[model samples]
Target: MVAGRRSGGRRADRGWTDDAARAGFLGVRATILPALLALGAAPVPADLLIRGAMVVTGSAAPFTGDVAVRGERIVAVGPRLSMRATRTVDAEGLVLAPGFIDPHTHVEDQLLGTDARARLLERFLMQGVTTAFIGNDGGGEADVRAVLASAAARPVGINYASYTGFGTIRRAVLGDADRAPTPAELAAMKALAARAMCDGALGLSSGLYYAPQRFAKTAEVAAVAAEAGRRGGFYDTHLRDESSYSIGLDSAVEEALAIGRASGAAVHIAHIKALGADVEGRAPNVIARIEAARAKGQRVTADQYPWDASGTSLVVALVPGWAQADGRAAMLARLSEARVKAEMQANLRRRGGAEKLLVTSGPIDVKGRTLAQIAAARRLDPVEAAIAVITREDPAVASFNQSERDIRAFMARPWVMTGSDASTGHPRAFGSFARKYAVYVRERRVLDLAGFVTRSSTLAADTFGLKDRGRIAPGAFADLVLFDPRSYAARATYAEPERTAAGVRMVLVNGRVAVEESRLTGVAAGRALRRMPREGTCPA
Candidate 1:
């Protein structure tokens, strides 16, 4: 009998279905029951059964089916299961797909913070993300084991993994100076990378666009990355330049490919994009470079967010890397100089002018205003106005620079996957996955439904070595998302960055319900997933 409630608020079992049930069981039981018998196994009752949903298995086409879950694994997946179930969900008219895995996120503060609501990570759960990777852009903690331990001590709502951050390692070993590490310092950094990998980090993650890391030469990065690579980990990086900030977009892509070759690791570029007016239409060129690398048998993949505006701090957006050496105090000291101010003004113009930069977070009055507006009100040049704001606090801004042409070109590639680059004061933090489904898949038709599911879940899982977590199959982890295709959409905007997405009907993490009926279930079923250390890498 049909059970529970349907999407349109109708009783699930309203229509009696003796004939329909018989038809559903005919071919399914004939095929499945004998195979179980041949294997000397019998069908057992399921802990939870979701019946009659359109299941979009990441590896296959969508089909109407039932998915059965035992304790923490999907025990059965097929058209019609006759086994008794402890509980059943009538998923009629809903789309059940593998929960999306976000490759980039900055929810560390919320995950590790003192606030109970924040710790639940309801924002991500609401976006239909069952698993997320943290410690991105070279900002992860150096002590990987400690971070995992601390996170596990509390109840979290979603599964997570992390990469050992190169920036953190550099800062730990060599402070924030724009210089190559000494031989001893380099060795020390390598040791730290090795330790982190052994302690369960996914790999070495670097933000070459930021300080200390930006100072390191290509060879230096390869040297540190080798430690993780030797232990069977891949290298994930935020390239040094997405536009013409330093090495140019094409050159940065080449550098990432080179690092992979030198270090013997696969390379995954984070938030791959052509930013700024200088390189707005360079997505095709970037794609060609990565494709060429792949043809040559090198492992290369990338992730892209759906938004045109990229989120970052004003300092990173405007200040020259050389001027940002040492720390905040030194950087502020240099910002006051005429030469540095001129350079900052030039950088601001290159990034599409003050009008394109919208301040998302900072002091009370400055939150939603554009840099141009702030400058006019303060009666100062845009550069000086930015300096004034930075002097008090380095606020985050949504820099509108990318073009729709570039965004669509990159997203259409099979190698490119979805990522939020999620951070505070950015709509992507709460709505990236939902927006991709709504705007790109549903509206723009950039990707079909199956394609979106594969990129968002399967590609990331396979690339990062996350086994049994991104597909719908027997013996896989029961991490799934059920949503109304008609209603799923992103609600968060630049002005209302904290608003969560809509239409995530249910979310399951490791066989536990984390969200039901688009609301958090107050179930923190998340676990800190650790990659098994390569044999002999860790001390016995």
Candidate 2:
């Protein structure tokens, strides 16, 4: 656990001195102190203070204490701070911790979209997530500079960082051909990854399970990833196979490790899971492999949402990657072929049949219905109905393929952090952190509060090199969440995916109140976080 330790005294006696606190307060102290001195008055020491909350510092065990914020940083953290503040909150019974950091999300559209209210990201705020990472699963745009620029132009309610995506780069250069990139094309792809890293992407992300990206061989991926790695970025990936599809789960893990080895990049598995019945109890084997690699000094880490069902598009869940080459139109045309239809039927059976696949979103009005239900209503075979649905619109599905046993196994690992893999039509988007607390931490005892806070915040911060975040301490960014432990729970369900969570009483982003008393304060204080390019990566 990443415990936040205070020096010079025991935990009970280690409160910040007034001079030290004022010095760290910087310009805020400079502006207010002299004026108050002229009037022979003492300046308020903090802009906002919360007293009597059980503080989970993301590093330290929970303790009843106070935290003071000045400007965008915390200046004081200890039990019973005596300094006065401009505003003080009585948080006698709530639990205060660093705001949850969602390491994987697909909210780029909502963040950069023109819809003002959507940009507030109230769902995440309600769930106590203050920071999210986007452009994941190899879907990030190669133009990192432009995306970050756009986000900066439009203020968002939550801070975010992004990764440049391999799928986008491959598509840009090879146009979904499902063939190995020629030498020049490979060089071009490498250049894009390098430029994205220099332009401030956190890393290179790949969804090898998705089309076009799946087409790239492991060597080709490593070559492209090496560009980001050499520039001091990690490689984040959705493995090419999480089940018995293509190379199988074990080989897919090996492929990811091989990429990390060949590219000299730290490997981060996105939404790590043993999907489908074929891979259901394989969590231990997978964890052992990653642990073995870590023992050999390879930096390997992963994140997982605490949900049994995984989310994906219907086509992605059932369609073969080889058939998806060239694009959707060609894939649709091939659906009529007898051989392709047979393969589709086999894939559907492997996925636990149509009953397990819940159609969540699309142009069709079948949201909340299963493919089996749709098949029966249309008087068609499940595979035929799925094809018909694809012909009209490719809908998203909630594939109930994961086992609770596997989820607990992965969650028990110290290296596994919390991530939502947030996307449209999935309950994980709005409820992952809350659900983790409610089900895993509070109920099942899979993790205690400190472990939850550590994985949800500190681990991601340390892994991604986010400075002064994921902890409650002097000089850390004042992103905090205060919630009623008794009531904190996920309200969203697979059926009601858009429902917000419950029991987050307040949230602070950059020392500004974004949510209070379980309501939005309409503050858009989030900054677009960018990794600084390594010293020689960019032009001087």
Candidate 3:
């Protein structure tokens, strides 16, 4: 069953395939079974009822039916839900699936800029994302509790979760340097992880490829992962290396797997992909490695954006890890050194060249231009251009660099879910989800509507162990999105990255209408989803 946004309508003869019906049946069992306990022999007074449309519950079951939302949970789901509700959404000719959950993002940095609340809600709701996981690639969310406090007070359109970044912990202890942690530094890092989890962090996240985090040893990362495991949290990571920068892609996955196995936490590879033409089709190898670990009963999963090119600082391509360390100030200092400048230039070309890194945001004129173009204007090589951009804008600017083919191949994998990997630095922050539907599903026809929604919605929620979301079942939280499938599209790009998506009409977070008819209602009804205690799921 597929549902799109509309109100006050009754339409029938929604033809669903036999597979869809079977999937819906399975959805009912997985999503609505618990709701049956509360509504046994009693009429449910739900907060909202969505009727007369195909309801795509994110389950293996194949059936079309009505969905009842009671409070924050779905109370009933079936062909005909005989229940009363204060509000009803007519979802004719639309897909009513679970709200999508973005696994990695950096929007938390918006709070650092003051005008955060408005920016966050406007950016997220338009994409129909009910939840976003912050603290990605070891970039933002310096203080977990403080960020959560701000999120709780100001509110936004979507729910937010966090991973206590291993990189952040490393920085807090060892400073932002690319060096291994000493015995005491490792202990201090573990203490910080424990404190973060106590303060409501969902898990430990590591960006081994980035500075500070790169300095961390596998054993050190495993220690932090162990803390998250004790708290019943999962370990999400930006692998040590997905590029040819240093560790190969397979080696990076191995590092993440080792941490998961040693720490007893479910390991999730953040923004899993292989970049550049040289590494094209490396997706299959990466997936095969992850699968091999899964075959061993290890908890392993991966998330990928719908785009092929990834966005990051242009300096990431130019400067080697050694010179890139010490944060922005240290980088600027190194650029001033003749030796460092020459080495950095050679490094960038060796990695992928300046043309590959397209600037997303920086100097007004350079925003959409590529490093190669910027170099031409400056009468310098691409390497010098990268250094110039880093010197002028710092690592704060954005770049768009990923392959379209690689992105689709990654998303098509059963274990691969969705993640923007875009925080503040990239346009994916505002466009990943919508672009997936608009470009891949609608334009390219790479996946059907149901398949696309499942990858972005139900599949993501399940990977994160979010039990109350990802389906439109009764008793599930009223986290919902309404939009016209044909009309849905992403408006943001590297040039104009902050724009919201085009077709999302309404969004509800925790049974509250946070977005109505494609506009934000200034409602911050999102909640923090913490790791819950469970048995048989946690590794010993």
Candidate 4:
């Protein structure tokens, strides 16, 4: 799908670029030019024309201009452009910027095993996100080819690319055993990573904090991540620890930096933060380290959700990795024993408490309750209550452990791009990008509008090797978002996670109108972008 015929490649029957058809107008032009001039009937030749916009042309300040899209690419962008078009949008007071890209996402569920592809992607479309990079937290399927192939067959409205998850690949080869892989096993895992890259995966992703991945040491991870580096790809990681769980947050950052060095891959830390009460104000230390690495000419970048609380499973947030080494059955077995239960309760109490963990999904009756509240209601310990909850369906929790100060610190960094890391019960899945503009830019004035646009779109695209996206320029894909800063807001919250973002006026994916006049057209007008080595350079 990345290399062949695509779903949204067909053009509207405008024939604006047909030279032979235009050649017939030579004799007619003499007569028609004057009459048309007299009548002021010069036609605009474009599939869609966005005019009178304050265009923020990636990394630059906004300027008044017009942007013309013919078929799937922007044909012209300046003060004005002559074109014959059937459709034109009067963006007189609107801001025209590149469609936002979610650098980290978990849309595999929407793309696969569902008939409601349009419904799932509509939330992103409404937020002005035109692309989402799947395979975050090392949870995408191992076979990138098969997964992408299936997704392409059921094409959604937004573009998506994937990473070869080290967790998935490891499980396939070693079956969740905690020991380091054999030499043969390592070779097999490396081979899988290479194959995924060959089949159009963007890079390698790892959730080193989670089970199975925690079992493998640094050297074992390097062996697998090296394949991605060989293809000029990156190592995108959910760091070994976000809190003071095991290695501490700062040490976890060092481990990610070490992987980038060990594997020769450009390193990207997903959801960069100093999480939990023990490490509340340590974001600066992490930033200093990344800055030092960049000074040495090492490519180190990260993505962060703009929310205070980070979303994850109750299992990963509470249960120790050792207890969940094999699977759910194994973890439950440990929970059944008295000694293991006591140890787990102590661990949970030490790392904040049940009061901090707010359940977001599953068991509809207790959906918005905290673990402490659930424990009180059930007349049992919070750890025991959580263990009981995990066994039914592994519901997600919004652990309110992040610091506003640390979040502001990380957001101020140049290399940190916008990613939701959105899961069920998390409002970010529905509204992070819009909040960056509405809350961070207009009201808060964290950064200027241009800087925000650059971070949300262009920076992420270039860093991840996605070509011809994340900008509004000649020859770039016509993925554009039109909005009014005053009107736009991220409307989702913790209790109501299903709400859509407000005030994104229009969105164009591959020159096709997706969200028109603030509503969805339900057009599946996106492509599956593959990794392009030429676009993988960090900007100076």
Best by lDDT: 2
lDDT of 1 by residue, 175-285 (tens): 998888899999999999999988888789999999978999999999999987777777999999988889999999999999999998789999999999999899999
TM-score of each: 0.92, 0.93, 0.86, 0.89
Q: After superposing candidate 2, which stretches have Cα over 4 Å from the reference?
A: 1-44, 363-365
User: Clashing residue pairs in candidate 2, if any?
Assistant: 3-59, 4-59
Report, for all candidates in order, the number of backbone clashes.
0, 2, 39, 7
- lDDT per residue, candidate 4, 1-540, as tens digits? 001111122121110121012233332332233244235466436677788899987845678888777667666676765556678788998999988999898877886656755433988999899988889877766677776666456767887778889999999999888999989999999988888876667789999998888888999999899887867777999999888778888889889899899888989999998888788899999999999999999999999988888898888887777888888788887878777677667667645789888899887766899989999999988888988898787788888878878988898888999998877789999999888778788887887888898889978876765555777766566789999878888999888887999998999987788998899987887766656332333221
Ranking by lDDT: 2, 1, 4, 3
Query: In model 1, which regions exceed 4 Å deviation?
Result: 1-42
Candidate scoring better on TM-score of 1 and 3 = 1
Q: Candidate 1: lDDT over CA atoms?
A: 0.85
Question: For residues 213-289, what per-residue lDDT tens digits would candidate 2 score against the true structure?
Answer: 99999999999999877877889999999999889999999999999999988899999999887888999999999
> How big is the positional error of residue 225 in model 4, measured in Å on the Cα after superposition?
0.3
Cand. 2 TM to true fold? 0.93
Q: Cα miss at 534, model 1 (Å)?
A: 2.6
Q: How do all the candidates rank in terms of TM-score, highest first?
A: 2, 1, 4, 3
lDDT of 2 at 225: 94
How do the residues 1-540 of candidate 3 rate in per-residue lDDT, one tens digit apiece? Answer: 223222111111111011011234444543544445345534546677777656666664435567766655555667766667788878777656677888887777553236646545577778888888887776534366675666555645577777778777787888886777788878887787776766667688878877767877788788878987876677888877776667877788888888898998888888887855456668778888888999989878788887645766666656667776877787788787888878776556544666666776667757777777888998987666676667677444443345666777777877777778765546687888899888888888887777876777777666666655776654456788877787888888766778888888778787788778788887767765544333343334
